[model samples]
Target: METDRQGLFRLPFKLPSSAKARSVGVYIAGALYAIGAWSFFDAAIYSRKANASSVHVTFVDWIPFICSTLGMIVVNSIEKNRLIQDAMGSGSFSGSSSMAWQARVILFLGFALLAGGISGSIVVLILKFLVKDFTSYPTLGMGVNNVVGNFCIALSCVVLWIAQNVEDEYSYSLTL
Candidate 1:
């Protein structure tokens, strides 16, 4: 006799299970990251080429972008299953546990850096532009671009996380 088992409720929205879907998500993430990078570059280049004001793109403006990119790289490089296994008590103290501890520390650092990057952008926007009373669009645009680019990178990280979590679905045959 076969028994019916209780299952968790499914979401109304479904992610595609095909490998192509995964590839598409990765491509989209890359595109978003590129857009963010280009936006920052645009601001920098604009400042060099046509800036009429004293305010310019400085090293401070680049720091947030660097932090975010580094965080994304660190977060993506971790093998997620190992962490999960460690959490579930499948890890040995000498080997798996140590690795898991390292992974967790690194992961925490990555997320901290990512959050710092986004926060730093907002700080620059306020302190550099708004606080200086530079309300004019041309002078303010550099700060705006930095904020927007950091936001785009954050979104790219989200997309990549969701894409990585999606699992392949298949069916199994039952014999009576």
Candidate 2:
């Protein structure tokens, strides 16, 4: 049987898949998430304090961000071993199957929330800001920030996932 392939792309440069790289990826992901959160916060503040237009950031504008943050937390908290072993059909414990099932369910929910957040952000931009004739950059920025913030959050999740998977594979390589 042919073995399964690994890594999305083979790079010309050999990047060390070390623990340090994993740590850096995690830190970068966190920073991206923070930037996303701050972007939304800045938008809310600008709307509250300096916005001359009637358009202001409201609770409706915050739902997407909340969902994204919660999703990130859920996605990052799952133990990777469970997911991998489950797929590989290696169960040492009686409850391993159930644990894997739970992990899958939770993981699915997390991804759903993440996707929903991105979609919701776009919806808010179009329905709440654009439709209301908030054409000027200053006023429109509120919605734009929401979309950008959610996108950054999604990117953060991707970085974290790649980092985690790479770390696991690195460990496997060492064992072999």
Candidate 3:
């Protein structure tokens, strides 16, 4: 990026090169993941030790968080290079369309699980907390925390995907 050094025309911030940016992006994603997990765990602890209300964090609340975490694992486990190589028909198994098909199937399932986790969180919030008229913050916060945690997990995954691809893009540019 070129800088315009003619006085006040300069931008406030500088953009990093993809190679330089990947590390920072990965760190940010990891931080978000940690914060998300911490937030959900806090809710559970509060429910057990501090909460005075009838509401509690049971196995039901854990289901959505588990689903989202599993989805993240499934999604990140797929080798992106394989998808690209299969698309370009340049792999050692280039003649085998089944590999690509299987990859796509797995990718779809992972995304479905991710979406389902978030949706399930909302359903629990409505059906369990909101519908019962538990409008107080102490009880309502458990549901809210679940939603936030699941959302952050999804966001962390998105950031990681972009961060990983940035390195690949930088390498590709160099090859060209």
Off by over 4 Å in 2: 1-15, 90-96, 168-176
What are the per-residue Cα lDDT tens digits for candidate 1 across 1-176?
Answer: 84432212255666787778888999999999999988888999998999999999999999999999888888777766545545555334344577777877887888888898899998999999999999889889999999888888988987886677556455243644
**Candidate 2 lDDT, tens digit per residue, 42-118?**
99999999999888898999999999988988887776666655555443333457777788789889999999999
Clash numbers, per candidate: 0, 0, 0
Model 2, C-alpha of 22: deviation from truth (Å):
0.8
Q: Which whole-number lDDT from 0 to 100 does residue 120 have in model 1? A: 95
After TM-score superposition, the amount by which residue 99's alpha carbon in candidate 2 deviates from its true location, in angstroms, is 1.4
Error in Å for residue 105 of model 2: 0.7
Query: Model 1: runs farther than 4 Å from truth?
Result: 1-14, 89-96, 169-176
What lDDT would each prediction earn against the true structure? 0.80, 0.83, 0.78
Ranked candidates (lDDT, high to low): 2, 1, 3
Give RMSD (Å) of candidate 1 vs. truth: 6.0
